[model samples]
Target: MRVRKLTFAALAVAAGLSLTACNGDDGTAQSDGSSSSSSSTSGGGSGSGGSEQGGGKDDSAGKSSAGSGSDAQAKAAKCRTDDLDITAKDSTIDGDDEGTVAVEFKNGGGRDCLLSGYAGVDLKTSEGDLSAERSGQESSPMVLKDGESVFFGVTYPLNESGGSGVKVSSLVITPPNETKSFSVEWPGAATLPVTDGSGSSVKVGPMGSAGQGGAS
Candidate 1:
């Protein structure tokens, strides 16, 4: 009887130990699984955050690139013709006995531009009937291009040149596509003496009267 009782106690203790070991193993396995799940979730969150930041950066860069491209296009579309300028070599010339003055036009823009058709200069006077005159030569509509210059003379016959000042009034430049007019002025003739000579006697006032009428 005592042997049987001892055997029963040993069996009970063995069963209890086995149950304890199984409980410990179950706890350890559950902890390991929970740690692995937390690590995976954290890694996934970080990766997602990185992707979102990268995407935002890409969008910003794309917008900047698009803006730069638009600016470049606008610049390219702008016409490069503002550098064209024109001036009169001699803004004023002495009028003939008929009160006719000739002016020589020059190009000062130093850049290329188009000059088609003829340009006219109007002499505005209060004393007499002054008109705008154009040189009759029909020039090939030209692209003045850069650094190219041409001269045309207009004759304004003044009725009386004592107290009246003449203005260039307007200058017309005809291009292939359109016509442009610029305002210009001529020197006033305060004291002009009457002379009787052919084309060789006409000269600009404020200076001597010995040169030719159409001396370029």
Candidate 2:
């Protein structure tokens, strides 16, 4: 019994010394552990926020680069007559009360080209060449790639008088200020009347955007 009591007393003294030793140390160790954990959390949050910000910046830069590329492409030289393939087709707007033919032009060259203002057109048949005047239309520069096409419209009042007027069978097309001209076949069998006691016969306009045909 005495030996058992001595053993219990020894155990109790050892436990007390352990608790005292823990209490004797400064609180720096505990604070440091908590600080380490806080630092880890703060670092994780900062890193995530930084990643999101960086991603946004990258997206903005990408769009800016795309815009710059488009601006560069928008700057191009005027179209050359030899590098274009022109076609004429029968079309009309505001009903069939008017006679209209659409001029579809494609850039067949290796480089981009620009076109503005009116297209110089002249209707040709066995009789003579009847030049078409401008229709006071305005347009901006249009850019086209190889094999890509743009179109314009040639509109005039339908003359049914059967009077003495120039009969048009074919069209001679020339790009603005270009010497070389392209020959476009007449789209319809109906003859184009140059003038039959009318004030004006035909008018030309600039080529519009790819999907929309414009005339003045």
58-165 per-residue lDDT for model 1 (tens digits): 999999998788565522121122444444434354443444333333334564455555443333333332334333444564444345444444433442646443
Cα deviation at 71, candidate 1, in Å, is 3.1
How much lDDT does each candidate structure score?
A: 0.46, 0.75
Q: Could you estimate the TM-score for every candidate?
A: 0.37, 0.57
Clashing residue pairs in all predictions, respectively, total 10, 0
Candidate 2, residues 1-216, lDDT tens digits: the string is 999999999999999999888876757688888999999977778788999999999999999898788565546788899888888887765557777778888899889887877788887855577677777777766677778888877766665668554557788899865788999787743565555544446777777622344322
Best model per TM-score: 2
Error of 2 at 147 (Å): 2.1
lDDT (C-alpha) at residue 34 in model 2: 93
Q: In model 2, how many backbone clashes occur?
A: 0
Model 1: runs farther than 4 Å from truth?
Answer: 50-70, 76-216
Candidate 1: TM-score? 0.37
